[model samples]
Target chain A: MSDLVNVSYLAVGPEILLTLGAVLVLMIDVFRQPSARVHAWIVAATILAATVVTWFQWDRVTGEGPFLAFSDMVVIDEYGVIASFILLLVGALGLAVAWGMVERLGRRGAEGIVLVFMAIAGFQFMAVSANLVMMFMGLEIASISLYVLAGITRERPEADEAALKYFLLGSFASAVFIYGVALAFAGTGGVSVYDIGAFLRGSVLLKPGVLLIGMALLITGLAFKLSAAPFHVWAPDTYQGSPAGIVGFMAAGAKVGAFAGLGRIVITAFPLYEAEWAVGLAILATISIATGTLLAIAQSDIRRLLAYSGVAHAGFILTGLTAGEAGMPAVWFYLAVYTVQLIGAFAVVAAVAGPTAAGSPMSDYEGLSRRSPFLAAVLALFMLAMSGVPLTAGFVGKFGAFAVAWRADFEWLVIVALVASVAGFFFYLRVIVLMYMREPAVAEAPGTMRARLEPVGALRWVLIISTAITLAFGIYPTPLLDLLSTALPF
Target chain B: MTELVLFFIFGALALVGGLTVVAARNPVHSAMGLMLTLFSLAVFYVVQAAHFVAAVQVIVYAGAVMTLFLFVIMLIGVDKAENLSETIRLQRPLVVLVGLTVVVVGVFVAVGGRFAWITGVVGAGPEVNGTAEAIGDDLFTTWLLPFEATSLLLIIASAGALALAFFRPRRREGKEEGAP
Candidate 1:
């Protein structure tokens, strides 16, 4: 059947590459002595190669899969292409960090790479999912990997606790999401966002309970992914427990892909039901800003603080989500900016946080400028960007988010954002003050961390590029704005 | 209709399964209850005509995942788990309260939709095929950028996780091994 061939050709390009890479890494891990492993790097390189190949094949109509397989559940598209590339790239970075980290933990093995590829593959499926069935499957694949990943360092009890909590809460959220999908399917005879959008375009509401309940449940599930208020309870614990590198990976890579999906669902498919969902979203946004910022201020632990800070930023992104047509491009640009800034900040933290179990607390940053002014300055720039100060990438992201919102007649949302920005400044500034302005506490632990503070590695260089772009965009944002102009969910 | 009857059966199973997952004293019992819950979920997926998804739900989630949970319980040695938390904590009350609140909120939100702002204005009902062709047409034409960007994002993640998880421990601290 042509169907079989088409499906193979269409889905096989990226899917086969990822699946084979994952399987290959596993097989090789079995034979290679743990002490003499080279397969991890090979796996990383192969993934990049596969992604490049997939990118080149983007000349065709992007969503056109080879055949209608999986019961028409998945489709390849520009969306899928972008998602796949990002997933693979971020996965490689995770591999590199793990390469350094595994030696630190004294656990050299193949399971980590296998799970990473598996998760990347899962995220790829999610990007291409066309129906509720595929979407749920994709989500499960990604989530299962992450659950195991949280506890990969099986030696750490906190890792186990974090994974357990993440697993349970994630499961509950998945159930709610699927239940909502079922109801939505029942109500509209449709499961995909586009299909739902078509059905809702010119109709008056019926069985409103089904739609409203579905939206609420779906939002609850997505809120957990976004790590927004109320549903964000698991983030800090999980982030703290997981390896610092994994924290960076999830915060940047996962957030971008997840938010794209969320934006599509809300702005495109469910816009017709704005009457039911809009107010709730606004309330959530407000709460996220308040709770996340306030909670972050109380955290002495760097990872926990970043986790809460991540929550507040998600609220900022939610504002764009609420802005409808005007919000899409803004949200996209913000996500890209957010991803880079976060990666840079986490890299610095991971590199410089001094010799404590969870690395140095916020207090350890004391006189970081004196120790490594170069590192402190780099981090300070990122923190300031996070604060949305002028001449930085964060400002452009925040400005775009607000501009679109005001254009969409949500001026009050804009005001709240302004206030939150000011409130957020206090915490970021405290980090800076401790680094440059204040003396470290007297009762400090021994073994001062003396790793070279220069941004020497490829990863560090990558962070520098992101920081430079942030500054460049802040000064002349027109190029990015133009690119954003075409990214639409309006 | 068979559809109506099937709904009630699976719904009942799901409800009971949920209750047992929460109330079971043993960790293994809870895991089994969760498995039942997941199975009921697959049944619902099957009822809804998602064959592949149903199979995945049963095999991947219920079988593979539940096995892991049970394994962990065994590894930790179920005896190590307390039948009940002795310390009076806020966890129990909070759990019960949140559980009841979901139900209450569900009921209210469901009923309240009748009074929805666009109740009289929006009127289309579910009848579209939602097949691969339909979704493909829309996605290829409209959702293209997000599609590609998301894949790119995931690829990056894959490399990073692999690098960390499979990373040879000898790169950075070749000297750490020499420590006496």
Candidate 2:
């Protein structure tokens, strides 16, 4: 029992450090009014320290296999560790990419950094927790922080609108999630994922009416978070209206956490009902792909376009899950590559549109190549990768997802995804064309000069790292694939 | 017979309160209706022998949350009536249809003779007494992680409120002066 207790502390070491770092940052900001740069340094140092702790936890999990901690409320496993790594990476990249906006916010910048730290810790808890109530707590913590971050630049009415819509819809989803938890408890008399699974495996229910409804509600709530189409109405408005710099992080971090939670709930806890849920997930994937691709073509704003594309990508990720546990490797790979590409693409948006700007009209990109060759090149690369062009990480991710879904007898979903992928190429390529082929709109107006666009400070590093990852993973994905193959829930 | 009578009375109160919350024109009246529903819920909890939960329902829902709601209403000013015109075509009909579907499904479940839906081994877990001691023991021991995690949620809520509501006076003045 003592050993178990120690392991539990070890399992949560990163979250503890992160929460302390958040409080420390807030305290330091209150006492000493420092530059946003100092807050960034503190946040970076905290993330680095947390990463080291996660490394140790990873070593222990890989050596000793997965173990339950804190009376099975938390699980220390490779799957959770990998998800944590992705979320941490997102936090770091998100902070760096949005550094310009943080600095622009002046004194409120520290609050932004602290919220990022708290949000990362919350999502990390979500990834690791094995109990339903614990997961819900983590979800709310992360969600409320994101809701605040959405409107951190309160000067913009659009930002306030985005925040209000997200808060209202997100709270409703959380309530639904807790309702599902209640129904599941009533049905199975257990709240721990493994315990519920054990109970289901041990008994055969003649009438699974309440349990089925509970599972459906749980999936619906998570589907809303994942922004799988039909539940994806809030994504476009929120992404378009929130400050451009941090939208990447918001989208990427939420997806990673939601997918991690969904994967565990479906693959670990409800595998007994896989036949039912897989079909349901496949139907959702089909609709998401179709809707995202079709609607993206109609969007004039770049942010709204990416938001729609993200919905389609969510569908592709869901397609992999239809293959059950065997498809997790593909899902992880797709998530990692896609999230980096997303951040990199939005980094360019931040550079071009100004970090605190809410909208990025496609017209803003007219002749971007002349304004800034580097930004245009990287953005185009991200676009190509997002559209799943050959020799890009996006292609490999989609291929892997489609392959798994095909093997799972979801061949029709694979087909629909392929057609959507082809259609997706249009909007992505249109961006490339506008950047490269068109003349600057300002150039046409005499006596007007459009300043050269350049990525400065942390945004430069974000682009470089994201681009490198996209290219390297595209050329060789073996290492990531091998690592993810070991990332199975225990 | 007394228990049934109490249940019916509180249930009626809850329904009325719920309808008023949706139908009342005055925001303050809606808040009061919400308080009524919450109080009725506490009564139900007490009737179920969940005295600890009943107290928490009254204290947290009726006392604290209702105060927060009223404060928001006061801050926003309750004089203006909310617009009830439909912004989307057929929204009212769609909502009614959805609500009807939920009611029908709930009724079917309740009267469908499926009360034995729970299939897990009975009494395999900790026993519940609905007392503070039993709840505290479970919360601290078996549910320690979730309980501890709730602290993070509270921290987030407070921090988020501060971040959104607390603006620096200098920036506010600058913005005001800069405005045309």
Q: Which candidate is the best by TM-score?
A: 2
- How close to the true structure is residue A26 of candidate 1, measured as C-alpha lDDT? 55
Residue pairs clashing in model 2 are none
Residues A341-368, model 2: lDDT tens digits? 9999999989988898898999999999
Q: What is the Cα-based TM-score of model 2?
A: 0.95
TM-score of each predicted structure versus truth: 0.79, 0.95
Q: Residue A144 in candidate 2 has what lDDT?
A: 88
Provide the lDDT at B53 for model 2.
Answer: 97
lDDT per residue (tens digit) for residues A9-104 in model 1: 455366567667766765665675455246656675678777777776455533343323433455555545555665665666555544544445
Writing each residue's lDDT as its tens digit, candidate 1 over B34-146 gives 88889988988777665666777898999899989988889999877574774767978887899899889867875765534333223654444445565566555444433
Interface RMSD, per-candidate values to 1 decimal? 9.6, 3.0
Docking class of 1: incorrect
Those runs of model 2 whose alpha carbons end farther than 4 Å from true positions after fitting are A1-7, A444-449, B1-8, B104-117, B121-127, B168-179
lDDT of 1: 0.69
Chain A (candidate 2) TM-score to true chain A: 0.98
Query: What DockQ do the predictions score, one after another?
Result: 0.13, 0.51
For model 1 chain A, the run of ten residues with the poorest summed lDDT: A61-70
